[model samples]
Target: MKMLEGKVALVTGGGQGVGQGIALALAAEGAHVAVAGRTLATLEQTCGQITQRGGRALAVTCDVMDAGDIERCVSEVVDTLGGLNILVNNAQIVPLGRILDVTDEEFGKGLDSGPVATLRLMRACYPHLKGDGAVINLASSAAVRWDASGYGHYAATKEAIRALSRGAACEWGPDGIRVNVIAPHALSPGLRGWMEACPEEAAAFVRSIPLGRVGDCEDDIGRTVAFLVSDHARYLTGATIPLDGGQAYWG
Candidate 1:
């Protein structure tokens, strides 16, 4: 049987990048997907791809920083898909700046959009997520290491996500809800420019990985997330899975 057959999943930031990859992977496994993001065009594109492949999907435009938007996104998913079994909190905006370089506004925006938004979504989906539900928060390698020049704000927010995931798992486990975090180093549209702009740094980064390569967003991180949300990982909760090709260990 298909791993996610008859399940319904909501993927935040599903319009593009790693979130899009995860959404497609879940859909391919037979789950109905709700692709949520701030951009309708990108969400539509993702939904179109899933539908073209004979998967059920819906495009939902949502601003993660806004609680109202999150509520609407969850309501739409439950109403349209019947009920939500999985939620991938993958919406995040990384503002590149050092501690001193980043203003209060930028730091606030990063935290509000990343960890805070994830918490709001978890609360909104709590009641409906009873019995074998899964919540996967998208964290980053930066959460576990230093970015040096920039990314203090982004890293801080991701670290908060890790904490939130662990706490939520402990509290919700009794309700049959599993919470976990995924730290992925994958090639996506968002990271492509950085990789190209600093080829040596990027290449050196990839060489540190035991896998001898950077990850492909869809096949690598996406597949890992699908597994985590599937019955195969029913015993897993509050774990941080580093899908970074072992770069975290060496670096």
Candidate 2:
């Protein structure tokens, strides 16, 4: 039997990037997946891909910034898919600016989407996840850089997310809910655009990584996420896994 057969998973921001990869990986593990995002079109695209691979999937429209939408998304997934076994909080709007230059609005956006939304979703999914479930929250390698000059807002928000995950993992351990965080360095759209504009810099950056390459969205990140959420990682919780090719690892 598959590791996640008969499981139900909900991935936020599953329309694109790492979220889409994680959703596909979970489905491939025999999970019924719900890909949720603000855009139904992109969500449906992911769902189509899963269905094409002989997997079950659902497309849900959700805006993580809205508390009501978060609640609705969880309820919809539970009602439509039977129950939620996995929750991936992968949607976040990164606010880039120096600490002094980051405006209130920008900082607020980061807080609301990063830590706030993650907490809201976890709370909403708590009932269903009890007795066996996994929650994967996203952090970023850029946040821990030696020169985090213009990522103050982004780093703060992501750190808060890490703190929240640790607290939940400890508090919910008795309930059998595992909460963990992942800091990934994948070829996302933003990174791809940077590489296109500055090929030499991109090459230098890749060389700096001990593994000598950026990560694959589906193969590297998705596969690891699948393992984390599965019983294979049953003993792991409250840990931050850096999937960044040995660069900027979290100790």
Which model scores highest in lDDT? 2
Query: Against the unseen true structure, what C-alpha lDDT does each candidate score?
Result: 0.90, 0.93
lDDT of 2 by residue, 105-197 (tens): 989998998999999999999999999999999998877898989987899999999999999999999999999999999887888999999
Show model 1 residue runs off by greater than 4 Å.
146-149
Local lDDT at 122 for model 1 = 98
Which stretches of candidate 2 lie above 4 Å from their native place? none
Q: Clashes in model 2: which pairs? A: none
TM-score of each: 0.96, 0.98
Error of 1 at 240 (Å): 0.3
Look at candidate 1 and give me any clashing residue pairs: none
